[model samples]
Target: MSIVDKVRELCGTKKITIAELERSLGLGAGTVSRWDTRIPGIDKVQKVADYFQVSTDYLLGRTETPYYALTEKDEPSIQADLERLIEDLDGLKYSKETEEFSEETKELLIASLEQAVRIAKMEAKRKYTPKKYRGES
Candidate 1:
């Protein structure tokens, strides 16, 4: 849906008309309606979103859900997992591999390992996020 549609829907929920919304926003009549053909600035978009108590992305129709409360603990939890995995992998016998792996190759391998761990964490969260109190971004 367009910004106009979102605003209209919000107006309905709030029991207000487009003109009333514009007036409430200190915008001239038809200002909000004109947004259908003309994209407004970030400031205006934020204003409207704030007024309606919705995210700008939601008003812009970027997402179906208006809110996604992420878990505040996810970051630290993921970090802890990564640290443990890295510590475990550090003890692995890389002598044979290191003989062939140049300094550059070693760095690349380390980076790749870190990235894989991050991806794994993300996948786990995406597939099995059951905590309503805390969500991962």
Candidate 2:
């Protein structure tokens, strides 16, 4: 499918609105709408790719395995799973600490934090489902 098609499908499935994408990507509403209409410019392309955690090629449907592959229904499921995992891990046990430390230790901590965020996002994506609410009646 074309990038526009893929984007539309992904958004529609996720219940993600154009306005939400625009706000998240810090673009004008028309920006994403235009993307929905047609292939966007490189900069706009990059913004969406970054937000979705996919490569520009993948966003363009140039890759088979989309790096960021989650439908609208997928987002909430992923989020719920991630939340559960975080809860199980006792994520609230500690806040990010800013302690005086050697530059190496600080860098390591930063790397760890980044990895944590990536893991959380991936976990959410893996558990995401485009259909069925978590606790809807």
Candidate 3:
């Protein structure tokens, strides 16, 4: 099915008309319905995805699922947590008095950053991936 059709299906399921969707999205009339002839810009596509709690890939027909399973942290919260993690890893506590850092210190810092990033990725995947799909993605 076309992305337009998928969108129409969601509209029906939600009991909203295309005009209502456009009004909610602040888009011009027939904006979404035009997907048949043209792909929307990234911003517009994201608006639709966010509205439906689905992924952009799903709207593009790349995935059968509408959205990833919700985790404890949504996107905004996850970003905030990641920022905090980065700050913890590179905060002034790690700053040496001397301008130059020893090779060992550099390696340790790099390793710590790598491990933190890996853990974050794994946690995210575990939370968002459907239970049955697991590590497939």
Q: Per model, state how many residue pairs clash.
A: 3, 10, 0
Q: Once superposed on the true structure, which residue ranges of model 1 sit more than 4 Å away at CA? A: 68-137
Task: Give stretches of model 3 more than 4 Å off.
Answer: 69-137
Can you list the residue pairs that collide in candidate 3?
none
The per-residue C-alpha lDDT of model 1 at residue 61 equals 76
1-137 per-residue lDDT for model 1 (tens digits): 88899899989989999898888888877888899889887887777876765667778777654543234555686667767876776665366655544577667766787777667765665445443422212
Give RMSD (Å) of candidate 3 vs. truth: 13.7
Whole-model lDDT per candidate: 0.70, 0.61, 0.70
For residues 24-101, what per-residue lDDT tens digits would candidate 3 score against the true structure?
999999999788899788888778766776677777888775545444545565556666765765544435564565
Pick by TM-score: 1 or 3, better one: 3
lDDT of 2: 0.61
State candidate 3's TM-score: 0.50
Local lDDT at 84 for model 2:
59
Ranking by lDDT: 3, 1, 2
lDDT of 2 by residue, 70-118 (tens): 4475557555665555456443444368344566764565566555655
Candidate order (TM-score): 3, 1, 2
